[model samples]
Target: MFEGHGVNRSAAERRAASLTTRRSVKKAHQAAWLVNAIRCIDLTTLSGDDTEGRVRRLCAKARQPLAQHIVEALGLGVVTVGAVCVYPTMVPHAARALRGTGIPVASVATGFPAGLMPLHLRLEEIRWAVDQGADEIDIVITREHVMTQNWSALYDEVAAMREACGPAHLKAILATGDLSTLRNVHAASVVAMQAGADFIKTSTGKEGVNATLPVSLVMIRALRDYGEATGHRVGFKPAGGMKSAKEAIAWQILMKEELGRDWLEPDLFRFGASSMLGDIERQLEHHITGRYAASHRHSPA
Candidate 1:
């Protein structure tokens, strides 16, 4: 463990911290590689879109060019779909649909995008999702606790969430927009990393202010420092409001320059974009045929 006291413990911690820094300085470019990757292939895939006639339209989307076009783009690999995120209720269907495919099913949990529920219930949600075969679970930290500067409570709670996660990866959402400051984001990132977050992600995509490059830069830099201060290999995910090949590449460049090459890997880095897939197709089309083809209207595109 990199955290401890006493002369011997301190020396060991220093060595571990040093090793971690050097490795992150090396892997920052790849492990956290920003996949211009995508999210929201199906509009109805988004939660809170429920309406009386919504299902009929969603069923239509499944049959039309929307799903086909999106799938075909995923096939070309000019881009990568970060993960296929869906509502808790949709995890089973998404798991079945995405099975045998390389993409991970990252399901939002912990009464997600809100984080206003009790601890036991939230943990049960994580347990249930993992049992259903969800590959990843994205849970937001309790903003109220964070606001009160209760590090011990926050750390223990996050640790519990981590234990509940078991094998399924935990993408701890800082909900940067709500936290609303580079300093808080940095502190939260450090705490989340310490608490066993596989990846520290930004907002839940339901927030108005999602991932910003500047915010991403701050978050990644903080993670870099934390990784240096500790040996654990924590990752970063700048989700929400991400769209466009240019945007992904820009963040990729940022990760490479600021964090180093190891940050580029899919395991370490990814984007959570509901509409970025269309932008990828447009970029691909330009690459393949040298024309900026107009994307058919779809949710988030």
Candidate 2:
């Protein structure tokens, strides 16, 4: 449907900027928003040096994203992140750590970050991660497909990856930074949904320009259109470069205003971030005690 879709860069920037400036939440409401952000975060650890120990620690954080004191102070019950995302090899570690926590283990498969590997091998990677107990699979798309406007090729690749996921939910990472234009981002979003992606992600978090407000806006609009046409609900995740509770609120506001409150839940929205939780914790503490704690007080996420 987005064959010759046009995206006005200036208008997108203006609208994105307005979301942050025009909306404000305070005190208890801000704290509530921050807690919701924690619930919708895909706590991630995808570095080259990721060890079993690090993955286990990250899962522990995912299970209890907020401090016990913070949870008690906020009068909350059992607050945990939406999922624990790790490399394919680290899925076992995360799964074991979060075994009884009811949190899903997500793995980045299909030649993640660049997705330059052969198609069959990439599909095999998805099956392997699923075999290793990944409840969700985040696969990167071939940016060349979008750049070349080969929608059929993009849909076929993503459809193959979806089939390979078995019972695992599939998240298609568009790596919008590399797509080169907002129009490409929108087209890619539609094609991925058509191919059966459970979620359309903004980036792999490895791109120089990962997730940005304007990029997310374009993707969300595409998702809205898809949901309208097909009556299917696909999730939206803005991964990378989003750090701070302010961004957490901004993105949630975008989802709420554009798609309504249903998109505010963890099932339909997530922040693909590792360090974003730390800042959110700091903000919650400030709301409770009227002073910001040292950043060190919040454990590494």
Candidate 3:
């Protein structure tokens, strides 16, 4: 298996910068790419005031992310988000709302956002969410372990969380922003995958800094290296701060460039986003009708 490796920040920065300056997709191709992005979104509502009603509405949007006219115009059929992500308490509502849609309900557990709770409590949260019908569980790693270079503890923590998830897929949120360096991001990626993370994610969307191109590059590289060593493909998610259709395309391009076209699918990549769908809808509308719709017109609610 591949252990943690060193990352040359300067080289990674140059590559990440090139991702933007390179030629972009246009017209029909751009519209298709945005549709693919829509299918890979973990339509999320992580607000403190989130209620069952709100989660149900979010699930409804996840089931039919695009308007009927837009779907017909684009020649796309029944496009849905990759999944619906909600807090543990609202998992049942999301599950019920998304029934028969085949869109999984992903719950953020393990004392999400700021994961400073006791280990036992965190583990129980995972089991509880799984029991509540979450098909996927996104858990946060103890930043202290990564900060202090306690690879053993970090690996063990994630491994246990994976077990607690039972049949539910495990997504280890590295909270890369708080790790403080690209090297730390790389190391955490390796450890999390080693500990059986199905997907390694960037942020909780509440950090001082969240997902950025440079940081995503480091994580993707680590994922590639790990796949090479173990022959196991791990997924990548860039959550938080990705609000525009342009940002979604940039990340899709990154996955296509770094890991090949296979990583572009919902099984291998996901955008933890809420409002992103609206912009993508607008862009897709412009692609079809030669005009952009107002934001309110494409609201998920």
Return the lDDT, model 1, position 99.
59
lDDT of 3 by residue, 18-51 (tens): 9968958999999999999999999999999999
Q: Write the per-residue lDDT of candidate 1 for residues 1-301, one digit (tens) a residue.
A: 2122112334333543344234432222321222223322322256586432443333332233224454464353333354666667767766666556555667788988888899999999999988887788889899876677677788988999999999999999998888755566767777888889999998888887888766676677777778777777787888877766556666666666767878877778877764555565555555444676765534432
Where model 1 places Cα greater than 4 Å from the true spot, the runs are: 1-44, 50-80, 297-301
Write out the backbone clash pairs for model 2: none
lDDT of 1 at 232: 71
Q: How are the candidates ranked when ordered by lDDT, highest leading?
A: 2, 3, 1
Q: Largest TM-score belongs to which candidate?
A: 2
Which window of ten consecutive residues has the lowest lDDT sum in model 1?
A: 25-34
What C-alpha lDDT values do all the predictions have?
0.66, 0.93, 0.92
CA-RMSD of model 2: 0.8
Residue 200 in model 1: shift from native, Å? 0.3
Worst 10 residues of 2 by lDDT: 92-101
